[model samples]
Target: MRRRLAALLCCLLCLTGCATLAPPYETPAPASSSHWPAGAAYPTLADNAGPLAMHLPLGQVFPDQRLQQLLSLAIANNRDLRQAVIAIEQSRAQFQIEGAALLPQVDAEAQGYRERRPADLSGTGQSRITSEYRAGLGVSAYELDLFGRIRSLRDQALQTYLATEEARRAVHIGLVAEVASAWLTLAADQEHLRLARETLTSQEASYRLIQSRYDAGISSALDLHQAQTSVDNARIDIARYSRLVAQDQNALTLLVGSAIPANLLPEGLQDIRIAISEPAIGLPSQVLLQRPDILQAEHQLRAAYANIGAARAAFFPSIHLLGSFGSASAELTDLFQAGSLAWSFTPQISVPIFDAQRNRLRLRVAETERDLLLARYDKAIQTAFREVADALAAFGTLDTQLQAQRSLVDATANSYNLSQARYQQGIDSYLNVLDSQRALYRAQQELISTELGRQLNRTSLYRALGGGWYTSEPS
Candidate 1:
């Protein structure tokens, strides 16, 4: 009888291994345009065709050795990214735990017990003592998974683990982008501070000349006050930019997760040049699918789909096997004696008959969750598409804007110089010199701001294109 039962159990296990109730998985079609939007804002195929044939690492993307080192440090030490990596490990463990249910769990067991029985209960006039000893290997309540309930649950966990891994990659990518931006910002602010100091020195010298003229009765009080106003404005800007530079340093330190070395810190814009090599954008819709966040969303959708499978399997009969092969003896000395060999097998079948609509409700919930994640996946792709498009638009025009700003600064500087010369020769009023100086200062500030924008836009474009996360491979 036992031999027949063992053969039957083996056959059932073999059959169960081939069953899966989970719906077939197919990647959902993207709900967006196939190609990038056409305009001057986007790079022409010829322009992007060369050099951009592959994805580049962050080190290659930034080109600046200092920025690359900082990126490495941030990836290693950033707390948020560290937590994300830890989360992936946690998810992996959970997946292992869930997947283990698909197989039988065998455990070795040994037990000894002594019991004293009351006289009446033992059916004797005196109390009696009994001892029992047993040792064996046994399989506990291991689900057979005949309907693939356990398999589906394991699949869901596996997908969830994969999603977590993608999420970690996403965090890593964002951390690199943030660290680069912070370094760039510090560089820009330092440049601004230096410019402000230089302007202040020049304005102070003009103020001293005006004061001397006023004392000699050659210049009016209005002229002296106006010159002092320029000096005061420069001083105010110096103080403001000084604070900004310090704040930028602090921000970079926070992103770096430790005090940065003075040498690695950006001293000025010129010190931190971000020369990112362009990456292949491929088809716009296809590129979105490659983005970490979008991939994570799709993994979540797949998990939900697996959940629906598990829920559907819940409506079928579940088979569980609990068996043991061991020896039992009343005396410890005979626990493993020749006559003590014994074994038992027990299989249980549970069929859901009436669960008050609970199973149906669970299936409904799982289906709804799948639908929700499907929508989220589509939205993630859309959001990624928009970010790339916006970055491209900014990238295409920022160079032109920077060029115009530089030309304006040059023209304003020349105008200021000519106006100051005219005033010294009494060819123009002091008011004209003051006006020109103000215009020159404003134009210089704008030029610095535009230059910062141009550099920042480059970083944005690199990030939007999902560069720095992986090495380029032949597509």
Candidate 2:
């Protein structure tokens, strides 16, 4: 009997290794074109021409030592990113819990019990007391996965965990890009403030000269008023830029999650040049697959597929084993004696016959979820393609815009100087001088703004190409 029982257990173990019912997984092709848009602006290289573009480390991406230091602090202390890391850990634990269910769970237990029986029920004239002691190692309701249900559930959990990991990577990339942009913005605002202050000083000097000429009866009241107006405008700009600089600092502080060091903060655009080299953009098909968000979406789709497998398996019979090997006796001291040795094996089989169509509904739900994830996966790819295209378009043109803006600044400066000289010699009206001054001021401001935009475009392109995270150092 013992040998037969052992053989039966072995057979059951062999039978428990069932084939998965999950549909074969195939990555759906994106509906968009295989290559990036073609144009002189949209450059492409042969797929095998060289290695795909590599992501630059944060240190290399932000060559400014101060920006690099701030990025490090943000990555370590940012609350949102810290929470994302914790979420990954939680998902990993949950996956392990689900995976453990695929195998038997053995537990050691000890117990003591006492019971009393009424005389009438005992068939004796008096009440009777009974005492029992038990100690054992047991398997309680361990499901033998003959239909792959447990296996499928485990796979689903694993994929979900992997998706969460990808999400964390996405967060890391976003944080790095945001910090770089914020630092650059603060620097630009500081430069704007400095320019306003200098312009105000120059305007005040001109106002003083025109006021003296008016007092000497050599200049009209209109000349004095116009010069004063220029001074006033410059003063107003000073105040506005001061406020903006403060606000930019506050924004950077918030992103860093702590007070930034004064030395680490940007003083001007020139001081914090975003001089990172542009990364090579590879073929769209090759690059899009590596985007963290797209990978996360694909993992979710795989998880949904696994859920469908589990649902399909639910339609078949399930077998569970509940058994215990132990000793039981009225006296605790004799619990392990020869006669006290005892064992029990209970195998339960459950066949689905009628459950109000619950199994069918579950299968339908899984299928619907899979379809939803499939749509989301495709959307992720499409969105990435659009972002890359837009960034590339901006990058191809911003340098030209910057170049034109610098020329405009130079031309306006020359016009201002010539107009001032003509006004002093009584060859032109003060209005022309004022007009020239205004034009020069506007052109200078635009040049600063354009320079900042050019730098920011590089950052955006790096992020759009998914080059900021997962390749090296954290930030």
Candidate 3:
């Protein structure tokens, strides 16, 4: 038995021959960028010791617990995230199947059959009945991964699984950002509505005062007409903002996968505040490694690398060990008897002697694909870094712009109030009062929009930095 084993090993070794495979992988370096956008030009906050692009610590960035709960629900119930999870499970199953290729497979087999044969040309006196029965334990086809084909495939599967995991994380981040953005829009719209109502109330009061003066034979008909026009215009905006707020609320509900509880939406815009600590992006390349998209891209590159290794390994021969042990007999009662026992062992080798260069072409194709993935990875990193910087700069500059807009709104409001009083007292013309009210209304609307813009920029920065969504903080 030892000699036979030794001979079988020799035959296996002879069939495999020798082949060289690629070495282990090393993470490629991230590319660098030089210039970034300016916050002064854009509506962004100044760095103020923080970088234009900052990596926020991941531990619970969402300040509000209610919003966090909504995000959690979205992660669990969102349709897109569920699909990504299913994809991960499929990759895991494929990994398991590929992993099993490196090990031998054993199975037990049992069968029984009956057949009748005619006595052709009187070779037998009469028709004969035959019965066959067999039972055995057998080793089925299994590949010996000498050149690491199966191992490479398993590794590829692992990378694919990781990629899917990152995809889910990315989706999670997106959902959180979307929910936050929608909430901000709702808040902004509500604030705009409030401002519109206030403006309308003030205009209505002015219209009544102007009509009283006109009835008292003090003010002109044009003054009452202008006052009525201002009130009507303000009323229109109130309706618009009210509609926008409701639309935004319904959209937020859809994103959250259920009706937004009364407690979920903040009472008013002032009650809803976005807490963003400005981040300083160290270097462009670092941003790529931190961004989930770039990480996913890197994983794809690794999967492609593993595929190339697998294709290269296909150039070599494959070895399989086969074994069978069974008992068989014409009589069913003796099918398992010692005298009916049989056993056989075979080691097979398959080499790609001639296949019209198919294997070589596959290797070539894999190489090209790996190269494509590498380039894509590099480009993705660059893009992520750019986006982070852009978002940071925008948020910083917008902070300053928001301040200016607030000041404008305040100054215009006071000016409008003084003008209305003067015009009622016959100290100024009605046209002057109309102009002031127009300016005040425009400023109020601009302030609301700028505030919303700032909040949106904050959300963009968080998404760009790949912040939040994960349970643990960023390393």
Candidate 4:
């Protein structure tokens, strides 16, 4: 008994001694900031003139509660996001399962049998063998993680789970941006439709007036024809805007995961308000941490770090402990007898004696993979910064454009009014009036389009800033 005890102790010490020699795990150096790609010459986010603080409730008033509700529903029920949620759950379960490997497992076994013995069976007598049920708890092949292999694997699984969560967040950020962009388009299209309707109304009135003047021989046929053409063109625009609205509606329906009722559309342009309030763009360095894609990339890099450690460990010897305990007996009643006890333990060590350089190749591969992930992470950060800069630059330039456009529209409208008055008094030819009106209409449309673009760009900036989406999902 002492000898057996001494043997078991020696086996344990052998494994423990090997455990002391575990390969040193070193985390790869973080991606260098110098490696981050250089973006364009756009102004730094800190120097940008947008709002310096990220405020909730952007204060761009959309009077349409229905649009807000639709946005909420889409966030909740969107198919892509739902699928992402399922993926997170799956990853969570997998991590948990892999983690369970670090702990021992216990189980119970039971058996009952009845057999008729034939002559010469069991050394001879013809007898009936019956066995009552017996049950006992057993442990089989429980491997002790003496070298932290299972722990490292569990850590890898954990990092993967976190990466999946970030992936889901990234999806959410994308989905919200999509919804906001679609909503902005819908709003702008509605505005365009409104302008088209107004223009059509004015053109129809002008056409009627010109037709009366022509019949009364007060104006030339050319004037009548020009007025009719304006009306026809206005009608064409109305149809085009109508089609655009329909398309936007379809897109919103798909985004929201359900059809939007007709009554749900905003009644007028005033009812559709875009939040023009700018959020604060923090320092460029902070922006790197804010972007979900960057965060996801970082998590991937971390997982790769853990993988390198695991691979390096493989270069050292591996120890496995395999053992099982059970009870058996030739006779039914003797199944639980002391003599029935059986157990075996095997302590194994497999050193890399020869593998034709396969182990070295694997280690090299792991190291290379780590480097690739590091590069990718660095690139992601740089890209994220560039997007923020781009969005901010567009926002700045578009703001100036929209302001200038509004001024031009005002000037054109005034000029058109003066020309129309002068022509009615016979001080200017009808051609001058037509020219003024056309310019005014074009300017008006352009201004509206530009304003809409400004809002859209603002939305893009918010997305690039990572907005409030980082905490959108629970940890």
Our tally of clashes for model 4 stands at 3
Q: Count the backbone clashes (under 3 Å) in each candidate.
A: 0, 0, 12, 3
C-alpha lDDT (0 to 100) for residue 140 of candidate 1 = 92
State the lDDT at 151 in candidate 1.
84
Q: Write the per-residue lDDT of candidate 1 for residues 377-453, one digit (tens) a residue.
A: 88888888788878777777777888998899999999999999998887987899989988988888888788788
**Total clashes in model 2, counting residue pairs 3 or more apart in sequence or in different chains:** 0
lDDT of 4 by residue, 103-164 (tens): 55767776676677766775557656655545556555555555655566666778888888
Residue 427's C-alpha lDDT in candidate 1? 90
Write down the worst ten-residue block by lDDT for model 2: 466-475
Task: Count backbone overlaps in model 3.
Answer: 12
Q: TM-score of every model? A: 0.94, 0.95, 0.87, 0.81
Kindly report which residue pairs in candidate 1 clash with one another: none
Task: Report every candidate's CA lDDT.
Answer: 0.83, 0.85, 0.76, 0.70
Order the candidates by lDDT, highest first: 2, 1, 3, 4
Candidate 4 residues lying further than 4 Å off, grouped into runs, are 1-64, 111-135, 261-264, 268-279, 337-340, 469-475
TM-score result, candidate 4: 0.81
Ranking by TM-score: 2, 1, 3, 4
